[model samples]
Target: MGNALTTICATSDIHSPQYLELFKKALANSTCKPDLFILAGDIVEHNNIAEYRRVLELINSVHPGIPVAAVFGNEEYVGSEKEYVVRYPNVIFLHDNYRVIDTLTGRIVAVGSRGALDKPTQWQAKNMPGLIKYFRDLPDKISSLISQAASTNLPIILVTHYGVTYRNLTGENPAIHPYLASRRMENVIVNHRNVLKAVIHGHAHNGLVESIDIDSVKVYNVALPARGRIIKVEV
Candidate 1:
């Protein structure tokens, strides 16, 4: 990608108040000064929005002013997004949007979203029937965002909360693969491989393969419990 390397430290599924300490410990042990920090999704448990502040506090204590880019997860809930935006104005909350970050090394485009599942979970299907249409349309929306980012002529990083490809969900039950992530999203990344440098995601706590390559684009399942450490990426 860029001549000067850009370092990124990323993780997700903190499920705060439960795994908060685990995330703190992981951050404490990290030695890299990341140009960017990514919270793929599920940073807090349920809709406990207050815990997000604590998570940001921990990150700031170590690397003050480090830009954080994030997407929503199932735990973030639907109605609570505004609370996070109002509470953390400095944070880049990408809900089916893109942000171009200019680091000391080079500029890169980060496209973020809650992502889509091939098949909605039973709970989702039952409670949020409207989501079926949203899920159906998400892949195309994400692709459009990537296409927009490509106009910048910068490498793009796709960050989402759900698994993008089945290859990374190896340990999870095959029957539930459709519920974990969508192959349609994977198709979007493969189609935009020219500028898509990597993909980072969470929500697969049981995923066995932490990282994989799809059409040469690196994909990471950065669930805190799955890897038990922060994932560092250089591009």
Candidate 2:
């Protein structure tokens, strides 16, 4: 109804030199210049802080002063290099956190978390008991952040390393769907659909690149495996 905010979302297991190059090209020549850049998650190959730095530098080169909001994926351990990533000028790490960006158009409230599963899978078993419990209980934690962002009365954009809706994971191996994302998280989005403009996530490499509606809110899979493309959403 008014001038829209353009957001470019890119995600999935980028850590290789080649993938990073592709990512840089995508952002530099985006279909539309982004007002806000959203890095959905799993950005590094193996907790390589240098790779994260490259991604940050590339993003800044593409869109100088634009704010970049990010979340972590299963591959990235929060404390491993999170402190370094946050040190970047305009990068905001939103793993289990929230940030509000005041754009020229209007206020943008972004909430993000690494998110977790509704049940334990093979991957969960590999982690220690404490971590397993933490991942399993992610739905409740992220839901609280959603509620907090909702109270801001600004357009809300959600970023996560895990897919919130099952439909968005289409084409991924069904046998490992439980390990990939959570359905409980989708319920949180459904409940707060009124103010939510878009939900972006990655992690299901085999997932479909689609835009589906949860009420009026759009949930999209921006994983790079299927296509090295950034999704553009107007808020």
Candidate 3:
């Protein structure tokens, strides 16, 4: 028989207090015992930070002690990141950063971020004007992180809140594809295909294509509303 695969259970866009029950049901019904649990982003609704605890509790009840990693989503909002980190010291909140997880199968590097958008949304443009520059600089920051992660010689898994490629954004309006995800981010992933293994992301509620491959790296849109179940990925 082939060697056992390292399983990762991933999901996102819980929008807590809205889809929390659905998320609970999905996790309860899952049969896979994941080596790692990943929350791609938007765990809480409108920065209702307290609800994050409920989500974490549910995960712990189902699979305790597994490494949990997450990136920030737009709903998580700005200015509240440190609070989330302080509250859940256990969760690896990767905001343009990376962490390494050692599993029975092997060690995997997880690079996490809110991701970027090719064009700012109208709301963002009107409010967070500074985001234009931030988004412009994000790909390079993420690329550097991936490059550093590669130095470890471990398979790298990218976890982001925003979609990385338009290929997986089907069912959403093509005209706003730039607002949903970034081709620049896609370029970064493609550039590091030599070491990157898989990419997980959310924020595409209507995304019809849940998974796609860009030149070998697998990309998964794990938004809870889109999948209706927790995604189990074996690596």
Give the candidate number with the greatest TM-score.
1
Residue pairs clashing in model 2 are none
Question: Candidate 2 on 1-235: residue-level lDDT in tens?
Answer: 2456555555556654548877876766677577777877778776665677788788777678877778877667656645646565467778687888765456688888877765556555665456677866777787788788888777788888877877777788777787777888888888878777888888777776567898888888887765577677778
List the candidates ranked by lDDT, beginning with the highest. 3, 1, 2
The residue-by-residue lDDT of candidate 1 on 1-235, one tens digit each, is 4577788899999999889999989999887789999999999998899999999999999989888889999999988888899999988899989999866567888999999999997889999999999989999999999999989988789999998989889889999999999999889988998888889999999998989999989999999998888999877
| Candidate 3: regions farther than 4 A off | 1-4
**Candidate 1, run of 10 with poorest lDDT:** 100-109
Clashes per candidate (backbone, < 3 Å): 0, 0, 0
How much is 29 displaced in model 1, in angstroms? 1.5
Q: Give lDDT: candidate 1, residue 229.
A: 88
Candidate 3 displacement at residue 155 in angstroms: 1.4
Give candidate 3's error at residue 148 in angstroms.
0.8
Clash-forming residue pairs, model 3: none
Which regions of candidate 2 deviate over 4 angstroms?
1-6, 85-89, 119-123
TM-score of 2: 0.89
lDDT of 1 at 61: 95
